[model samples]
Target: MDKHFLIVSFLFCFIVAVTPLKCVTCHLRTRTDRCRRGFGSCIAQTFESCMSLKIFQDNILQLSYMVCQKFCRDLTFDFHNRTYVHKCCRYNYCNIEI
Candidate 1:
């Protein structure tokens, strides 16, 4: 009985340690330089990162958004002379500045 209890306790600890955290989700966009207020709930899943993205056009900032992400490479991409800035974080609701 002692051995069984020890094994069960270890398994429970491992499960709790590996579980993912919940993160807030929201997107903000505006062509006129004003984004409306929005509210969102936390999402708990296998995703281990929260990401914030910002895009700019002709030195004028365009879109801003945030989402729970599965991968976290922390890189940026550009297309059609437009730039994409990507940032990743590990804490819950840490994808601010979007």
Candidate 2:
């Protein structure tokens, strides 16, 4: 009985450890800061992380995008009078507040 219990416990731990991270996903956010389209959740793969991207035009926020990104990197850039900020996180739902 002890051996069986130990094996089951170990398996449960292993499964939990190997489970992929979950992240909030939204493709478009409205001006009122509400999800406008593609609202859902995603399970991140081994090479992926949760990413949030915010776009600002003339210092006013214009859009927000969130998803599970592969090979994610933190960055900020400007293009065509708009600034884009990209942020990445590893834990589950870490990008929720971004």
Q: Give the per-residue lDDT of model 2 (tens digit) for 1-98.
A: 99999999999999989988999999998669899998999999989999999999999999999999999999999999999999999888998777
lDDT of each: 0.71, 0.93
List where candidate 2 sits over 4 angstroms from the true fold. Answer: 1-16
* Candidate 1 segments exceeding 4 Å error: 1-20, 31-38
Best by TM-score: 2
lDDT of 1 by residue, 35-62 (tens): 5444364555664577777787886778
What is residue 94's positional error in candidate 1, in angstroms? 1.3
Report how far residue 1 has shifted in candidate 1, in Å: 29
In lDDT terms, how accurate is model 2? Answer: 0.93
Clashing residue pairs in candidate 1 are: none
